[model samples]
Target: MENTVLIKNATVLPFTRQANGSLNLEPQIADVLIEGDRIAQVAPAIESAPPSASVIDAANHLLIPGFVNAHAHSMEILEKGNHEASPLELWMLYTYPPLQSQHLDARLCYLRTLIGAMEMVKYGGTTIQDDLLELPYVTPEIFDAVAQAYVDVGMRVSLSLHTINQPLHHTVPYLSDFLPADVKQDLEAAQGLSDDAWVDLFRQVYQKWQGYRGLVTTVLAPSASQRVTPDLMHRIATLSEEYDVPIHTHLLETKTQAITGPELYGESVVAYAKRHGILTHRTAIAHGVWLSTQDIELIAEAGATVIHNVVSNHRLCSGIAPIRELMDAGVNIALGSDGMSSNDSFNLFDVIKAAGLVHSAMDTSYDRYPKAADILKWATYGGARSALLHNEIGAIAPGMKADLVLYDLNTLSFTPRYQLPIHLVYAENGSSIRKVFINGQLVVDQGRVLTVNEADIVAELQDRLPEYAVHRKQILQQAERIRPAVEKMLSTAVSQSLSIHRFSRPLHYVS
Candidate 1:
């Protein structure tokens, strides 16, 4: 007996690629038939449906494929709105402080991940590439808890043990020179596992948690190029090749980081990764904001993906990514909310709108600005490619996974809608999302989640906040001790010359 659900009389937006390599989206009133976990049919009319099939009337509704969040960090879910606009380097010290002593309980990890997962699913996000990292190091229990949250909520997740093997001073340029002897000693004492131990940690977690629910899978995340050793990168590459999984890593996201490649590796980070076999079609680079023209070429040549975190970039003052250049160079672009602490939300609708508008300043010609259709494509198809699920997900068509979002046409966002794709990019904010289905299962309906108890999770999070606040203050206190020195490092790096600049204005003349 096959399970089936038939959604009737909805305006279906099926994405089709044209001969020119652009997406063709045609919205037609149709019925979508889901057989088990896959879409069986999408047509103007379905004359026959199984007697036991469930049916929903979707008149005046717009059906589209759910958004794929190509890159994110579930670990930062609890840190939302805790900081103001700051440089990435300075912001990281507080959010990911090295001197932290406590580890989050596994149950707390589950609850925190659920909070983000619930927000994502409610807001039309069906898939996430979560580069989840735990401070100090990741453990099997913590990894399982996070993975289980996504499974329990019925959303697809590509989970990675996001880690950095290199010492703190080695990752950021000029950090050792700026660090006081006492601070340096404390950081060295707090250093995490060795390279080989981190590899074993990944293997232990991957073997147990991979394919847990056919929706949760593991990825190789080495944190960043400058933050990892050649040995670790090679090991990650080997594992990636052996499993055919995606590699999610951060690249140059800020001006300070832009100087890191030439400062540390004598080349761009992309070239460094290529030398280590880490740059491949399966590689998905998060935040290539400071990549050079040559770096972009190398990424394109290797068939790698660069996820554009537009909202986070602006929030952290990281600078705009060369999305137009990347697209022109044949690099696939995807969108990411980045982290809760940075973007402050899990809504891809916000990311979509921001991504559509942020690139206009990149060029004077309007023709070069991002198209609403292209932005939607990046959020869906490009993200699926980044997640290594291009063949299985990212489209609303026969043989695609039954992950879909139905937006109410009567909502204010669509009330006299001129163009639906445009509204989805420029106007919509997930408020009109009436129903969301993942893997043929209805997880969100009429602004409510069906899979988990949001109330309970919210209550638990609130209950733990007092204690959490204490730890946060302590972390901030520790970070404040090094704030002066870190600011100096940032100023020094940004003041240095680079082949390209991503800032809105020339940084050299700032003072």
Candidate 2:
């Protein structure tokens, strides 16, 4: 007999929008049947359940498909609140250097990944696309540690070994000058090391972890167009094709890349990717904030997905992505919280609210932004599509993976609620997530994580915080000391730079 579970008497939010330009929010008390790891049935009020079935009463709760975080850096959770006042460029100097240098060890890396996954799961995110960029120091043990954490917590993960081949001399502004001339030359010569290293590393990781009980999978992550060469991009694309895995990358994230791509590569960054045949259905690009109209068109035509980290982009002042334009151009747009260090939170509801508000403010039209249902789709189906898991995950339909979140409507924020979807998007937060189920397993029940002891995890992090802080302070001091030189270098190199720019395009009111 198959293991069976039933969730009964819940308000089912199927994330399916109706043709009437309104959410399909009709309240129906239903029973969801889960057989093993998949949703077996969704019916309106089943009278009786099998004797072997475990029944969960989801009274006064909204049952929805679990959220999909399409792009993130889970390893940076420890660096949160370090660079709040810093802009993108300065933040990179002060904040990222510490992560790249001191905190790149195996223990801390796994701990951070665990904590990040904990935070995400607590907030109802079932699938996470983690762009693991600290690959230079990663090991199989570290990857296994992180993967085990995800499995223990009952969350799905698409893990990637992020690789960047650009020389430190070309990438870091002031740090290059600080190095001895000979050392700088040697570092420049090591530009291609990241590609070869990551190819081998990920090949090993994928072979070990790709189908590990269907809980973990691996992807090839070339950091970005500017950070990778054409040859490396082609190799990544080919490897993704060969293994039938997904490819994740950053694209047109900053104005600097958009403006400098023509000078460096004789074409726009999107054009460069296209020339190398890197854009495809299995590709998911994070933060297309500076992508032009033509770039958006090309990406849509290529059937690629873009993840919009609205809060993170706003916090870093990285400029707003043309989400309306991208959606209008038929680009699949998903929601991501980015790294906790940049966004300062791992809550997808916060991102959903921020996405709706930001786009509305930009377009000066209420209808131009995503509606409550649209945001729901972005967080669920759109996210699954971004990670190339649409067929297996995202929806709460029969045959889909049993990844579901139950949000309580009894909270103060959701009082007097007439609309379930709107309240979920605008009012809900981590505290409202009462239960979380991943792949037919109850990982979090009654607002507590069932896999690991929360107190012990917190205690461990508290014990390690001071050591991380010391290293963080040292790196920040170094960045501050070299700030003037970096600014000078940036000023001399880039003629036109915008600190905070906004772009707007008319969205066809989709109902």
Candidate 3:
């Protein structure tokens, strides 16, 4: 027998936009019927349901689609606060080096993923893109463990085996070179592992966990264009085409990357992608902070999606993405919190707030600013579209998956709320999350996760924090010790390059 649930007396914020630019925020005092794994119906009130049906009274709550976090690195959840103040390159150098050492074992990685999943679910994010970047210890067991953690927590996830072809490269060219020699060499060796090995690993993982009970899916992530060689990119793209799955990559996130793109490839990064025919609807580029106007148009024409990690960009000092320009160019835009290490939080609502504020600041036109509803759509529908799960999830309409979040409007944040969407975006935070349902299953109810013991999870991760702290302190100390040497090396290199440029200037100046 199929399970059914009916949520009654809630203000339904459909989050669906109309033909006109205005949002359809008509507060519907309706009953949302969930039959099996999809929304059965949305009506003013259902007279009766099956006797065994579960009924939830949502008298003072707001029912909306669950938030879809389009990009995240769940493995970095444990490394959050330690690297918060450092610049992007320095932080990566200081933090990620330890993971390549003995710090990140399978057990620790799984625990981090579990904790990350819990944080995301607690904050009303039903779906997330787990961009698990290449770990030397990454194995089929690690993939299964991560997937199992998500399933155990009842969160929808798109798991990507984050791949990089040149893992040993220092500083990614545009970024500072801070990687230690040993760490760089180890990563390079890992990257040299045959593509056939990765394919075999992915095939095993996909067969074991893809679409596991309809909550988990597999995605091909090539890490970033700069990190992977052109041949590897082509192979990954071809693999994605063959598997009929989505591909995720980081693209044009910084000015440095934009400057380096032409040097790496004969053309711009987007142009190179276009040449390889990898700029398809199945591709989603994260960040895209420095894409050109032409690049935006190309993405739109190619039907690709851009996931704007506004909070991560600000935290890392990466400039704000031209989201307004991309939207105007008909490019699909979605929102992501990035890694916990970058943004320092997995809360999707926080990300929405960041997006609204940053875009509003950029445009300087209040009327043209990204509205709450616009971000709401991006969080749900645009996210699903990015993951190529548009038909399965996103909205609260009938036939869509029963992925919904209930926000308690009885809280002080929503006091005397004139407009629901505005209150949701500006005032409310994760504390307002009353319940969440994914795939017709009640994952969180009354501000707690139902599938896992929150106290136990927290306690377990807390106990492991001491060991992580040792590693954290060791890495930071090592980085601080080596910092002077690395800085001197960079300074010498810069001076030599400048001298060459100065000496090479034309001697016969007609002017």
Candidate 4:
């Protein structure tokens, strides 16, 4: 028998756009009827509920589509708050290098991925574009485990085989010149998977797992131009075409990255992407913080998505993405939590709040500012576009997949609320989450995940933390050894004058 859920008397956000370009709610209390995994009806009373359907009384609740974390890294949940830095290279060196040495098995991979998925779903995230990179490299077992964990958690995930083709020393510009002989040797000697090896890995994972149960999908992530070769980027582009799946790439997240395209390809990253045939409707540009005006135009023309990780950007001091300009250029803007290592939580509610507020300070034009509903759009529909699943999810409508978030109207965030959409964007936190339905499954009920024993997951993971701490301490010690060189490189890179300015951090700060 097909499972059905009848949610009763819920005020919902239809995410409808007004003529003045602001967002408004549907202005109706409606019942959402779900049959199997699809929304059967959304109307007044929903009178045709089947006898076998489970009824959920959702009175005094706000039902909206679950938010999509368009770009995220799965493994970073284990390394949360281990290191903090404001610049990209320094952030990577301090935060990521330690994990590269931590040997991981399938179980660890599953746990790492589960924690991330659990966090996302717990905080109103239903779908995510997971850029899952195994530390050092990806193995077939590790890859499958990550994807399976998402399904086991009942979350929709587009998992990417995240790897870079470029050597470590070459990935970063001018860093090799700044390092000591031994340090440079260590970095230069660091090898990643070859083109053929990566392709084989992709084929292995793809053949086994993609499009799993229609909840799991696959994306080919070439990491970035700074970390990926042109040939690999082209290959990934081809795969995206062949599979009809979106491709995600980190583009111009930092000033140093913004410098790479000009230094190496004699153009901007957007132009370089165009040259490599990577600029497409299927391409998702993660952290396009340093893109130029021309770059934005090209991306809009190509119909690519620009994923905004506002919390991640602020944490790494990566600067504000030109979201207003991009939106004006008709570029699809999506939101992400990045990874717990940088953003510290997969709670995209926080990300949604950050996205709504961060851009108000970036530009002077009040009219161009992203309204609260705009942020919701980015969180929902824009995110669906990031994974090329716009038609199926991202909205609460009949005939669509039943992925919905029920927020308690009694929460403080909605207290004395005059407007629904505005209050949701500005004031609400995760406390408002009453229940979450994904693909017609009650994955979260009464604000608790039902797929797995979260406490047991936590307990089991906690049992392993003592041994992991030894690795954590050792990696922290290792990070200190290379901090001086990394800081020097950062200083050198910061000293040069650029054609433009992205970093709002003044050249000097006053006490």
Candidate 5:
């Protein structure tokens, strides 16, 4: 028998994309009916209820589609508040240093992922495109632990075997010239697992966990365009085609990357992706902060998505992305909080607020700024596109997956609310979220998770914090050996005179 649920007397944001590319977000008071894992109906009134249906009195509640965190790294949850803000390359040296040994046990992996998942659920996020990378390498045991964590939390994840085969210096610009011989030798000794080996590992993981329990799906992630060989990129493309899944990768996130793209590929990175048959509808490029006009056109023509990690962009000093230009060119845009190591939060509402406000500084014209409704759509529907689940989730309508969040309208965020969409974008944080449903299962209700012992997991992770802090200090001390070389590479890479500008000011600007 199919499980049924009926929610009564709630305000609904029935988000449906229209033919002209605008979202229909006209709010109305309605009742929602859920059967099994799909929305059965949404109407002004649901007159009859199924005999087996569980009912919830949702009076004075604001019902909306659950937010999708299109790009994130779940493993970085432990690194929150541990690192200082620096340029992308400099920060990565400590956060994901190649020389660090893999030290996390399988239980630690599970516990860390659970902390991230639980936070997202508490903040009204239902789906995450976890472009997850394990330091040094990924093992099947680690993969299973991560997947099990998501399933246990009752949230959705598009997990990727995100990795790179090229040497660390090869991926970063001017790194080879700056690294000392001893440091270079140390890095080479710590070279990653071979391309064939990772592919084999992914094949095993994909065969085991693709669409497991309707909560977890798999994607292929080559770390970036310049980070892998052309042959590996083609293989990744072919695998994506074979599995008919989305491909997630980093592209042009910093001015250093902007310089590296032309230096390595002899053209824009987007052009290189096109040459390798990687720019497609299934391709989602994270942090496209340095795209050119031509690059935007190619991505739009190929129907690729650019996930704007707005807060992380600013937090890492990567500079603002040309979001206004991307939106003008008809390219799909999604919002991501990035990893906790970078943005330090999983709250999509915070991301939505940032996405709405930050782009205004890029353009003086109010007309060109992102609309509140559009930003909300990017968080929901655009995120669904990034996950390749546009047809399945990201909306509140019949036949869509029953992933919804209900906010108490009586909350201060909605007090005397004038415009529903505007309040959602600017006023509301995660505090107003009273109930969250994923796959027709009420997993979070009134500030508590129903699926697992979140308090126990949080306690276990907290108990190990002192141990983890000691380990992090050791890693940072080891990383100090290479920090000067990385800083030199960053300075030299960003000093190059690229024709485009993503920085708030020109490279030569003096304070």
Candidate 6:
């Protein structure tokens, strides 16, 4: 960040909201001047540069604000592609046991997060909201290891502690009824961390690594509504108000979640969060896949942001989120790469395409579909808002932090290009990202990370993966033992009446 850098003659996509509330994806050719960690100016001609300024001749390049990934799970990078096409309930059972088993070493946790951050930076992602969980319980030392990984890899992160206090049998609707006594006993014994213990852990993390190297931040993440008690939610809300940090939560990722409210608490899950005083402008709700019209209105009124994880929703058989309705209701929409365990990739480029194309299938009206510009907006500035960095990182104007990316317009995806936004959303996969600058420091040049040793990191994982797989044998077996009962629990819950239909196919029509 010490040296000034000048990007010459790059075609830039300036994000602007239209008077009609639509996205304007207009491009302009300009030279960008970077002075230290912030943009100095952007114009047709930026004349004055110091002698040592780095010059990038971008004659035909697409310069965009580095992607702000609104949602992610860095801890799950090691567990990608582990679960095959399972719903949220079953997927949880499949993924969480190893963490509970205490077989995952702290070094493995660091490697997991480092590799994920590498992928994100390589794919032009500059910031992420990582809702990480340390199985069995969360500790400051273990959480700080993941934070150090992000710091070393040069990615801005909102490191959320995604811990659950409620027992397994109590997390879902009548899950205890299907499991045997031995399994029930196991669930009770493996309650992970207590509510108070988690609170102390959050305080420890907040004190130790909230703003390390100006890249890492913290968020209060109570795993989900059914998984965390109301009193704990209030505590988190109080902390949020005191610290003024972003609040992250998951709501209605599946049809079962959409019905959990009335069946358990006689309200919508969204209503339950609202009543607990958890909904606020600082709050970002992930996976609004099953939100009703009223729920959308409530979110709008609360000034909350709905994070759309399109890839995970589709991969897990979670139904499509109503982006059209949410946008129409004036709720700021953002995109996320949920977790490598579900998404299997940290590439926000693919997420953009999924966001662009998925909503069109639900509505026949062409105008109701998400525009390419709209999707790009979500990936950049909308995500900035989600991470509570909207004032700093998402835009490329003068005085903003110099987080930007240079994409090769010469690639086949952009070669013989039509509209830039359309091609970017429909075809690009981040392979053409030539350079990435975070805080005006060039961390990625020519498709490789410079901040960390990429080759050694990859080789280490390759060598250790087999040993890790052998170690995971027991945990996978335990997940298999509970899988059938959870499947039964899902079947039973699907029959409970709900006023909304989020799934593409109905299980059993009440009508």
Q: Which ten residues in a row have the lowest lDDT in candidate 6?
A: 502-511
Candidate 1 stretches greater than 4 Å from native: 507-511
Candidate 4: segments with Cα more than 4 A from true spot: 16-24, 98-102, 507-511
lDDT of 6 by residue, 287-356 (tens): 9988999899999999999999999998888888989999889899899999988999999998999999
How far off is residue 383 in model 3, in Å? 1.1
Give the Cα error of residue 240 in candidate 6, in Å. Answer: 0.3
**Candidate 5 residue lDDT tens string, 1-511:** 8879999998998888889987888988899999999999999899788788999889989999999999999879999877677788878877887787765777888999999999999999999999888878777888899999999999999998988777788877778987889888888788577888988988888899998888889989988888788999998899889989899999999888888877876888779888997889999999999999999999999999999999999888898999989998999999898999998889888889989898788766988889999999899999999989999999999999999999998989998888999999999998999999999899999999999998899999998888778878877886888888887877677678877788777543121
Clashes of 2: 1
Q: Which 10-residue span in candidate 1 carries the lowest summed lDDT?
A: 502-511
* Tens digit per residue, CA lDDT, model 2, 1-511: 6668999989887765457433355667788999899998899886566788998888888898889999888767887775574345556666555224332556666677778888888899999998876633455666777777777676899998777777644543334655556545544554234567768877899888897887888988877776777898899889989998888998877666666566567777888888886788888999999888878888998999999998888776567888888878878889999988788778798998888777777745776777887787788888988888888887777889999888887887679878877887887776878888888888888878888887887788788888877877777775665456555545543445534345342111111
Name the lDDT value of residue 447 in candidate 6: 93
List TM-scores for all candidates, in order: 0.97, 0.90, 0.89, 0.95, 0.97, 0.96
Q: What is the lDDT of residue 352 in candidate 6?
A: 96
TM-score quality measure for candidate 1: 0.97
Q: Which stretches of candidate 3 lie over 4 Å from their true place?
A: 17-23, 98-103, 174-192, 470-511
Taking the tens digit of each residue's C-alpha lDDT, what string does model 3 give over 1-511? 8989989998898765578633466678889999999998898888777888899999888998888999998877887775554334445657555235442666777778888888888888999988877454357777877888899998999999877656534324522355566645544454334677887777888888888999989998876776667787788888888888889988877554565566557566887776765678899999988788778888999899999898888777566788888878878889999988888888998888888777766535778887888888788888988898888888778889999999888789899888888887888888989889999999988787899998988888888888878877766765564455444443333333211111112222111
Report the Cα lDDT for residue 188, model 4. 56
Weakest lDDT window of 10 consecutive positions for candidate 3: 498-507
lDDT of 4 by residue, 1-511 (tens): 8889999999988654457644456557989999988889988787788888899888898899999999888878888876574676766755567235545668877887888888888889999899987656777888888888999999999998888655555765666766678766665556667789988888787888877877988888877766777887788888878878777889989877777777767887778777787889999999999888898989999999999999998888788888888988878899998988789899888898888887888768888888877888888888998898888898777778989999989878899968887887878777889899888899998878999989988888888777777766776776666677667766666666676677676442111
Give RMSD to native, each candidate.
Answer: 1.6, 5.0, 5.7, 2.4, 1.7, 2.3
Query: Candidate 2 has which clashing residue pairs, if any?
Result: 21-511
Query: What lDDT would candidate 2 get against the real structure?
Result: 0.77
Per-candidate clashes come to: 0, 1, 0, 0, 0, 0
